[model samples]
Target: MTTKSIPDILRQSLESHMAEADLRDDDELKELLGKLNTLSGKVAAAKAQVMARRSDKKR
Candidate 1:
């Protein structure tokens, strides 16, 4: 992955950690975790698009 993807990579790590956390009644953290998960999906899609573009350039 490139440097541009670093932040998303970090986000993914954070999302994972948060998911593993025991936030029973923390609505704010719960909402944040959901948002992070959604954002992570977008980041992954963006990364895939970037990789595809790179491959196309090679061809």
Candidate 2:
């Protein structure tokens, strides 16, 4: 069986946790939003690194 990718696994886990949380509470929602932003930044950086490596291989 093929293994799930890191991004896919992270997205699934985040969705599951978000569904369980009380988003109606402003404080909790704000915290979750902050965490999401941090995760997004990390994912973007990882993508950039992968792209850079791919470009280097062509040189």
Candidate 3:
């Protein structure tokens, strides 16, 4: 299987549903929101790691 980022997965899922004229239930939306929260944390962690590496290289 190919690896896809969380945002890409989310976008593709939503786009497919949109094309099919399907409605999302509250529970399904909630799960997507949870995924978004997880993505946010991952982004923050990556930013911190990059900053730390840059700081180290500057020293």
Which candidate's TM-score is highest? 1
Write model 1 residue lDDT over 1-59, tens digit each, in one string.
34645445655666677678733436876576677668767887988998999999999
Q: For model 2, how does the per-residue alpha-carbon lDDT over 1-59 read when each residue is reduced to its tens digit?
A: 44555655665576666688823446865576667667867877887798899999999
Please state the error at residue 40 of candidate 1 in Å: 0.5
- Per-residue error for 25 in candidate 2, Å, reads 5.2
Task: Estimate every model's Cα lDDT from 0 to 1.
Answer: 0.68, 0.68, 0.73
Q: Candidate 2, after superposition: displacement of residue 30 in Å?
A: 0.4
Off by over 4 Å in 3: 1-25
| Residue pairs whose backbone atoms clash in candidate 2 | none
Arrange candidates by TM-score, descending: 1, 2, 3
Quote the lDDT for 52 in model 2: 100
RMSD of 2: 4.7
Q: Lowest summed-lDDT stretch of 10 residues in model 3? A: 1-10
Better model by lDDT: candidate 1 vs candidate 3: 3
